[model samples]
Structures are given as C-alpha cells and as structure tokens.
Target: MSHHTAAKLSRSIISRLGTRGFSVNISETTQTFARLRPAFAIRNLSTSVSPNGSPKDEKNNSISSDKSQNDKIIPSYWGVAPAKLTKEDGSAWKWNCFRPWETYTADVSIHVTKHHKPENFRDKFAYWTVQALKYPTHLFFQRRHMCHAMLLETVAAVPGMVGGMLLHCKSLRRFEHSGGWIKALLEEAENERMHLMTFIDLAKPAWYERALVFAVQGVFFNAYFLAYLASPKLAHRIVGYLEEEAVISYSEFLKDLDNGSFENVPAPAIAIDYWRLPPDSTLRDVVVVIRADETHHRDLNHYASDIQCQGHELKDAPAPIGYH
Candidate 1:
C-alpha cells in the first residue's frame, strides 16, 4: 500500500476502536506508524504533551481515580446478595437483607402529625394509648433521650414483628399473598432492633429501665396484637402517630446535642457500619440518620392506613420495602 493509503487505513481503524469505547495513545500510534516509514510518520503524526501531562492520559487517570474513590465510599456490606442454603431435606433456602431502592440520606426532613378527636371512639382510643405511654416517658426520661430511645426502640420493634407474623398467618389461612407486607414489616422490625442495639452501646439502661422495657414490651405486645386483630387500620394509624412523636423526640435530641447539653461522643461502630456514616461520625450523626428512619416508618404506616381506609387490603399495593 502507498504511504498515504496506509496512514488513512490506520486512522479508520483507530476511529472504529474509539467508537467501541477503545482508545489508542497518540504516542503509541505514532511509534507504530514510524515503523512503516519514518519521514511520512513524522510528517503526519504529531502529539502535544502539555506541562501537566497529555490530555488523554489525564482523562484516563481521572476516570480510574473516580472509580477507586467510589469503591472506597461504598462498602461491600451495604447491599450484599444472599447465598443459597440447603435445608435438611435438601430443599433450597435463602434469606437476605432488604436493600433499599434509593440511597439512604440523613439530610431529608419530613414531619407528619395526626390529630385524633375525643368524640371519635377509635381515634380517641389510639390517641390515649400513645399519650398514656408518651407522658411518663417524657416526665421520667427528660433530657436522657439516649436511654429513652433505647427503651422506645424495644417497644417499637414489637409492632412490626407482630404485624408481620399476623399477616403471614392470615396469608396462609386465606391462601392469598400480602403484597410482600410480611417481608417489609419483618425488615422494619429488624431495622428497629438494630437501632436499639446501637443505642444500647451509647446508653446503659438502669435496672429499673430494664424492668420497664420488659413490662412495657409484655403489655404492649399483647395490646398491639389485640388492637391489630380488631382493626389493622387503627393499628397502623397509631404507629404512624407514634413515629411522628419519635421524630419530635429525635429533633429535641439533636437540639440538645448542638447546645452541648449532650456530649458529642463518637458514634457506635454498629451505627457507622449500618448507616455507612463517615469514619468521624458523632452521636449527632447517629441521631440524624435514626430520625430519618423514623420519618420513613411514619410515612409507610400512614400509607398503610390510607390503603385500609380505601377498603382494600395491604395486599392490594406494594409495600415500601427497605424504606429506612
């Protein structure tokens, strides 16, 4: 081939490779062309190396640097896939964490509240039940929101587990699916349990508080079970209101932290791992994320109530899995 034709063929091949996400370094291509004919290659091929570096080289380095940074930022544990297991009878079994569809953020703020009238029997019942529990919590705990949170999480975890269990049984009995509500509720229960675990590391509850947790869990579990049986709509509405109070309480906790009323201790290891928080995260960071979780629960329970009010089962719609 003539020297001119050879140069044209090489340019065409390079363009085709570039279209397929491939690139040839200009210097390398020039060297290859030099082997064909020194004078022609030197005349046709030219490359500029700037003071910093070649622009193409810098761009490639920057892309690789970005990929490495992202890999470091996102931990492997964030959304791990499950491994399959074999049952005793050789049947396949698998279980995994509920991964959220969207990234978790502590910056988003959502506050929702519901007012229950004294004349409305069901609303009144739920209102008093939540108030009866909240008044003592505030009066006793006062500024000790960490301990209060530990206690509250213990109770909060109960409703989801109970709701999930009931729904599972109902699904089996009625031969109908619950639109994944059981799995969603179970995931919520687990998430709340992790919150309790995280707080336990921060605040050691007093013996009385431990007893309080036990007594409260016992009574509340049975009461909530009966309440859910009687009316799932009322149960969900009550949880929604309870979560609103949680957001308020956490907001107060944040205020206290900012005012230096509460020491800004390093966040627990569990909190850091679960929330993918920065290495230097403090108790205030933990509270911010926990408050976000409560907000999510508040919205979800209210949505559930709305579905029930529309004369439809939770099975009629998809549950917000891994919302927290």
Candidate 2:
C-alpha cells in the first residue's frame, strides 16, 4: 500500500502494455491509473498480507527498472548520448547521424557518371583546377583509398564552414535570416569532419600525412574564404564539382574493397557508434555511408548554385536541413 509499491506497479503495468502493443494514450492512461490508485493501494495491502506476496518479486521488479533505465541512453548525431553525462563511457545507445527525414543511401550509383566540361573560360578554369588536383591525388595515393579519403575529407570540410561563416556574417549585417542555410552548411561541415575523424581511426595517418592535412587545410581554408567572398555561387559550383569527384573516388574505393584488394578490416568503434552500424561492420560499410553523405552534399551544393544561376538569393529557398 506504500507509494513506492504503487509507483512500481504502475510502471510494470505500463511496460507490459507497451510490450503488448496496446494503443494506450499515455496521458489518458496515466490519468486513469491515477484515479484507480486508491483501489490499487487497497489491493496491495491485502496482497501483502498473504503468504504468496513475496518480497523477492518486488526486488526483482526494482532491479528490472534500474536495468531498463541504464539501457536507455540514446545517442545523438555526435555519437554521445542525448542525456547529460556524469561520467565518460556512460552512453548505452548508438544511433546514425542521418535525421529521420534524410535518406541514408547515396543518390548516385557507380554506373551513373558525369564529367564537367568547360562551358566558358571560368568553367574551364574550375574544371581544370579540380582535375589538376584530382589526378595528382590519384597518382599519389593509388590503391590507398584510406589515405585518399583522409586527404579529400580535409579539403572537403572547408567549403561548408567558410560558406556557413560568410552566410552568418551576411545575415547579421543585413539583419536578415539565411533561410537555414547557415545551420545546414555548418552541419555539413561537422559531418565531413566526423568522416575525417572516423578515417583517422581506420587509417592511422603518418606524420607526413598529418603535416599534409595542416598545410592543405591552411591554404584551402584561406582560398575558400576568399572565393566565397568573391562569388558564393562559384564557390558552391566548385564544391558541387568536387563532390562529384568524391562520388567517383568512393566508387573506386568500394570497387577495390569488393575485389579484395584491401583488407576488409572491422570498422572502427567510432564509426560503428557514429553510424549505429552493426557490431560486425567493416571498412566497406563505413565507406558506403561516407559516399552517401558526399552524394547528398553534391546535390545540395549544386542546387544552391542553380538557385544563384537563376538570379535568386540562397535565402529565397529553404535549405535542406538534414538532406543526408
């Protein structure tokens, strides 16, 4: 008949009802149970007086509730649990970074390909610039897709941050909102950074490669900032083209992995936790997810360029908040 006993009984009943797929409206159910609490207390008093009402059952139920609570720590996009943590290593759940509305698969197939060609002097310059960088990477990293991905991610994470920062500043200066573009671009930047982090655990970059990341990031960050300032449209178009190349590179990575050219090492724990991947996931699984993210970024940046091409500000259209 105690308050503790009543609370435990209510929880047990609710848990059983949920498991059985009962269509109980939770608020209404709670109210109904609250009204019946007096009856429950009376029943409990009688039951406790009987020989069959063992304290062992009560102990077991309490333990079950504690276990359930311990197991309910759902992970957020950053691979940490949603709840405030009191200690490290307390998270009990894992979830994929993709939002509920986002499709977690690559939009483009390896069979479907596109090659950007020179439409004008500017287009020629962009196309040639990307190709110049791309071929050298292909030559340098040849069969080492992990290193290739690591380097590409370093460059890839730049545009979104720069674009986001510029858009944020413009919004503040103009006293206008950016139609969610700033948040969307920042999220994209963070996602790309996570890709780099995951690859770091998988590939364990050498000292030279670490040095290369610093140099590339430094130069590219400044270049991209200036480029975005000069023409946001062109900057977006360049990123779109870069993402297209990324898709192709990832396609090659997948092919090599599938052909047994690279060891199908078990996926890193960070990857598994971040992507909510199966415990038995491998590097191929991680690549598939990263390639999908790049495809989404490609589509988004190209869409932004199209808006600009049509003589509309990005603020005129709603940004895809969780496209991937």
Candidate 3:
C-alpha cells in the first residue's frame, strides 16, 4: 500500500489497542480522531492561558509577560498601604493630613459683602444667634488676628460636623442615600478644620486660648448637634449666618495685613500647599483664599436652609459640592 494508507492502518490499530487498555501517543496529524476518542487529555492545574495557548500558573508565571519593572517592587499589601506621593517638582510629598488632589486655587472673585436679609422668624432667630455669638469673640480677640482666626475656624468647623453626623445616622436608619449632602457637609467640616490647621501654624495658641477652644468646642458641638436634631432648617440657617461673620472676620484680617496693623508674615507652609499659592505668597494671600472659602461655605449653608424652608428634605435635592 501507499504511505498514506499505511499510516491510516497504523492509526486504526492504535485506536483498537487503546480501547483494550493499551497506552498510545497520537501525533498531531491524528488529533481529529484522537479528539473523538476519550483518551487524549492534558490536565491544566493553572488558571490562565498563555498567548501561545499554553497554561500558565498564576502563583509562578504570568500568562502575559509584563514589561515594566515598576510592577515587580509593589508588595501584595500595597493596596492597603499609604500612597507614595510626589509634589510638582517630583520631590517627596509631605503632609499626611491631606493629599495633593484636595489642594485647590481659591476663587477670590466671590462677592464677599453680600447679605441674606432675615425675612422670616427662622431667619431672624438664626441671624441674631450669630450676632450674639460674634460680639464676644470680637471682644476677646480684639486685634489678635491670628488668635481670632484660630477661634473662628474652631467654631466654624463644628456646624458641618454636627449636620453631617446627623444626616449620616439618618441615612443609615432609613437605608437611604443623602443625595451627596453627607459628603458635602463632611467636606465642609474638613475644609474648616484645614483653616484651623493653617492658622495654628501661623501662630501657636496661648494656654488661655487653648483652654478657651476646649470650652467653646464642647459647648458649640453639643448646641449645634441638638439644634440639628430639632430643626435642620434653623440649624443650617444659623451656620449660614455664622459663615457670613467668618467672611467678615477674614476681610478684617486681610485689611489688617494690608494696613500694616498685622505684620505681613510669610504664609505658613501648610497654607501655601493647601491654597496652591506662589512661593512669594504672604499672610494676605492666605486670608484672601480663606475668605473666599468662607463665602462658599456661607452659600452652601444658606442653600441648604432654603431647600428645607421650601418644604423639601435635603435628600430631595442635589448638593452643590466642590465649593472649596
């Protein structure tokens, strides 16, 4: 017979012998018939296939070879580790309290002197409460610009935390989302806190000032929490008026710096990084950015109050985020 016929006859004899419990290795040319037979098998213990269609063990070799050396040094637990950060010049980043992504150039073009007239009883009560709180701080700080800013930020940070906490608990209780209000309010709190941090770097608080902060924070936190629980509208309105006072205070701080009443100190490193200011920025630049941030906070709280006054839950409307 011809070579082709002879090969076919050999394959037929191997198939019969394989059925009779004889082991036979089939060549690629007979793979089609081998597939029809149940004897041809390659057990794959790995999870991946190579580009050339071979199994690759995930614990040993990758199916697709990665070219970059960067992939090799990453620890398996890198997902849970702190980020390796860099600055604009690729130097190592400092400040674990915040990240580069959170830094922003403040929009100093915001209208700072605008007022929300207290047309209703709720508004009136809110406005007067702020006035009552403002005079004491003004009297205490007097010309101490740095001290005043520290105290103002400490107090300003409280309302957002209160509101955010209450909203968070409510969301959990009802199994509902907060329409971004929780995150917005929490961000507002953190922004206010960063203001405090910047001011602390500018001037260290005296023992009395530290004591004052302790007392004021305790009282204000409890008061705001209760107010939020009772009436979110009034609570937010009160915070809105308070932020108006904050803007006015920062404006005064700016004026003092400009007039040489308060020395034009170099901007704190924290302030420079947080506000994305120039290398030559001074106390005046920091105050401008902070004042602008207060304007935004003022608007946010006022907007929240307006929504509630219009007979809607905070969740009924979308929050205006990215204020800072």
Q: Mind sharing the TM-score for model 3?
A: 0.75
lDDT of model 1 at residue 267?
96
Query: What ranking of all candidate models by TM-score puts the best one first?
Result: 3, 2, 1
State the local distance difference test value for candidate 2. 0.77
lDDT of candidate 3?
A: 0.84
Worst 10-residue lDDT window for candidate 2 reads: 55-64
Tens digits of per-residue lDDT, candidate 3, 60-173, equal: 243332224223322221122235677989866678789999999999999999889999998999999999998998899898989988988998998888898899999999
RMSD score of candidate 3 (Å) = 13.2
Estimate the lDDT of model 1.
Answer: 0.76
Screening candidate 2 with a backbone cut-off below 3 angstroms (N, C-alpha, C), the clashing residue pairs are: none
Better of 1 and 3 by lDDT: 3
Between candidates 2 and 3, the one scoring higher on lDDT is: 3
All candidates' TM-scores?
A: 0.66, 0.67, 0.75
lDDT of 2 by residue, 1-324 (tens): 999999999999899878456675789889999999757855664322124322222222211123343455332222222332221346533334432223233443533365445566655666677778788778878888999899999999999999999999999999999999999999889889889988988778889988988988899899889988998888888888899899899989999999999888999887766666778989998998888788888878878987987899999999998775
What residue runs in model 1 are displaced by over 4 Å at the alpha carbon?
1-107, 111-120
Candidate 3 — number of clashing residue pairs?
0
How does candidate 1 fare on TM-score? 0.66
Ranking by lDDT: 3, 2, 1
